[model samples]
Target: MKNDERPLIACPQCDLLMREIPLPSKGAACCCRCGATLYRNLPDSLNRSLAFSISSAILFIIVNSFPLLGINLQGNANAVTLLQAVQSLWDQGMHLVSSLTFITAIFVPALEMGLMLYLLVPIRIGLVPPGVSPIMRLLQIIKPWGMVEVFMLGILVSLVKLVQDFRIIPGVALWSFVGLTVMLAAVASSFNPRDIWAHLDKDNDGKID
Candidate 1:
């Protein structure tokens, strides 16, 4: 095999081996045998992913800091930020539940967003930082654990149940959380792991330098 030759890739769905083909700008390639999408070369994917990740980070800060819901019961008002909710659960002796909530709702999402920014920002400047491979692998591993959408659904269910007893006031953080969930999903969908690897390889091959 020559150094200039494009490598072959196996179809994810059917395991059919074929030479990788370059996709037109903003186009996708499909597997000939399985008719499954092989890869996509989305135009400006890096910029878009970076934008979404940054937006997610900002929303995450708001979600953790501001009150998610405010309740006025008999003229007494109480509100809870996302972190406070987790702490409240722990204070109520639900240690395991609180830990899970903290991990899924806070830690995983923050880490994922941070990693995306760290990776994408440098790559956009034509630089591949060290540990790109392992970091990317860790990103993939933790992607499903973030669970922002699941947390939102849980909040909605809780709000429905509590509406009968209390005056439910949705806070700014609640809306920010909703936007953060959408941004995170968009970042994940728009980012292609293969694209990053290909770009890194191309850079190393002196193609981009």
Candidate 2:
């Protein structure tokens, strides 16, 4: 009932409520009921998250700039970049599919990585940037919208089917897209919002506000 009391944390998987306990540096706390990891106190989490964000941003640029796949059919060569694929769908009147593909494959992932860098880079230096809370909330909302891995699976299926009819050549952008997906996932796992909250609370002298 006191503001100074340790906060209560509910296990996300099981909804079991328990008081939060202090964790050692580079330690993890888990839910007792479901044995799911509740939070981690990873050493240098901010720096690691910043690194991942930067890596993902570079990979994202590569994914959009270069061709993803090349095909040769009857001596005719064609290549498709990520943007070209979306544009082709739109040109064929599949506007909805084109928009969805662009959002999930390009927009959401880029936004997530950008927000991560914006938040973590300042936090790493013991300074909280303006609109930190709102930006963090936006990041959470966009997190689930990033479906790069799912898009990669669809690409793999298309590649398999296309290979049967034409010469399929995977491009540099395709590999970069794979790397971007992995980097994004790593950044998500490494960056715990609770850690950010803790840092903010400390900077504000025991309260986020």
Candidate 3:
């Protein structure tokens, strides 16, 4: 298509109108006004996103399935899982904190990763499923709410304080949560909405190919 007829994308930072053009596989488009990232043209965005999101999901399961920490105090042994930790907080009357912890660390991340996989898996097979627009919007809205790394940091800090009093043994879930935090970050970086739209564009008009 001609330059003027090419798709125009406004800068998300400053609303400057610019034409969106084909980019190299490793190339990125930046908003000229504020230098914010517009989009990136990564090779095989679908496959990469699918792989990372799936791995993150698995790690997330491991995080909740096993014990987060094993502790011994005065000859008593105890272990806690992710949900148990939240429950402990709630039992201590920190209801709001516990609720926030459950929502951000578990529910939001799971929902985000689930939505990502829902989109990626089908698009990998060349099918853009119904409700793509709403799912995409939901992902955007909840992406900020999935603060796994923040929760991880809080966990580590609390563990440090507890170690002075109790014999704390790191559990399988602790390492798994660490990995999940990294993998979730990878999933977010690999997933680009523009790439999904490219698929929709191709399917919308077979003549474009």
Candidate 4:
């Protein structure tokens, strides 16, 4: 293998080996053998991630605002939102878990979304925003942390446990979470950072002529 050769990465899902092909600019490559996709192109993957992040953020607010489920135990009833669960953990002396939940579910996704919109919208107009490269790098770092589905899994598990103790009733927040998850998947599908940049570069060159 020469130093100039790109190394092949294996698919974690299927154990298929694949090489990275050079896209016109920087973009994701696909598995030659199994057609599985590899690598996300563009710092703007942050932007595509933002599409879901924004919706997830709004859903996060709603998930916190209202109770996720209600329970009836011997005619006594109680309801709790996702945030209430975190607060309960803190009240019960589980500070570390609460902090982790808050940061992963709330802070990281919000930061990723806000930074992406700040960068991409300006680039769409053909002006490189100040600190563009640094911001792009930041977007790449934050992209993986926007795990709304993981949070949803936690919610589902909580609901299952609550049902054993009381009559668990789902609320609007639950539905919102479902929608948020779908939207996040959609956002991921719509964004191909390499594709967007290739078009952007084409447009930029057109203007120079």
* lDDT scores in order: 0.76, 0.75, 0.77, 0.61
Which residue pairs does candidate 2 place in steric collision? Answer: none
Flag regions of model 3 displaced more than 4 Å. Answer: 71-76, 155-168, 205-209
Candidate 3 clashes between residue pairs 3 or more apart in a chain or in different chains: none
lDDT of 2 by residue, 30-67 (tens): 99899999988888777788898899899889988987
TM-score of 3: 0.85
TM-scores of the models, in the given order? 0.81, 0.79, 0.85, 0.58
lDDT per residue for candidate 3 within 1-209, as digits (tens), equals 89999888998889999998888888999987799888888898788889999998898898889977564545677787768767766776768766876877777778888888888888888876778888888887876765656765575466447444323347678788888888877877787788788788878763221
Better of 1 and 3 by TM-score: 3
True-structure RMSD, every candidate: 3.9, 3.8, 3.6, 7.4
Which candidate, 1 or 4, would have the higher lDDT against the true structure? Answer: 1
Order the numbered candidates by lDDT, best leading: 3, 1, 2, 4
Could you tell me how far off, in angstroms, the CA of residue 89 lies in candidate 1 after the best superposition?
A: 0.9
Q: Pick the candidate with the highest TM-score.
A: 3
Per-residue alpha-carbon lDDT of candidate 1 for residues 128-170, written as tens digits (9 for 90 to 100): 7778878988987876665566775565455446344233347
| TM-score between model 2 and native | 0.79
**Candidate 4 — which residues are off by over 4 angstroms?**
1-54, 69-78, 124-127, 155-169, 199-209
Model 2 regions lying over 4 Å from their true place: 1-5, 13-16, 33-36, 71-76, 155-168, 206-209
